[model samples]
Target: MSFCSFFGGEVYKDHFKPGVYVCSKCDHQLFTSRSKYEHSSPWPAFTETIREDSVSKHQERPGAFKVQCGKCGNGLGHEFVNDGPARGSSRF
Candidate 1:
């Protein structure tokens, strides 16, 4: 069974929801809709995107964190700040 992710509107209904958003390219479960504090960011505003093992951080754009699929190494998206709750929680 093949499964798509939230990227490009290709997500499987059975696994799509607010819990742990996994990557289609990678079977890594990250982020959730609930973690999204409903703010406006250039990209998807996620309070957190899974634990440390689910993501890979690479240097890009001089000094930036690049999010890549842990399984297939697909470029899912980039993460940003200045939004969500001010609780200063770990985004892992």
Candidate 2:
């Protein structure tokens, strides 16, 4: 399945609760989320992700972010601005 089926939102760039964005492409799960003051990047952006082989970046005209899922390949948006100056991370 694709992310659009699970978390399909016209504009996922919107701020959301804190959590991790599982890879609909790889079923890779980890810690991440959209903080209250996170950057709203158009692509799926996770302030934090699995430090190991859990996530992997793909190739594109610009580029697309994909999560490593155990089941299948999942698209977890792209990496945007993290509240490093603040706290928590945002997934868009």
Every candidate's lDDT:
0.53, 0.43
Q: Model 2, 6-88: lDDT tens per residue?
A: 44454434536555555555545644553223344344334454455555555433333444443454544444334333444
TM-score of 2: 0.41
In candidate 2, clashing pairs total 24
- Pairs in clash, predicted candidate 1: 50-92
Q: Kindly give the stretch of ten consecutive residues in candidate 1 with the minimal lDDT sum.
A: 1-10
Model 2 weakest lDDT span, ten residues long: 1-10
For TM-score, the strongest prediction is: 1
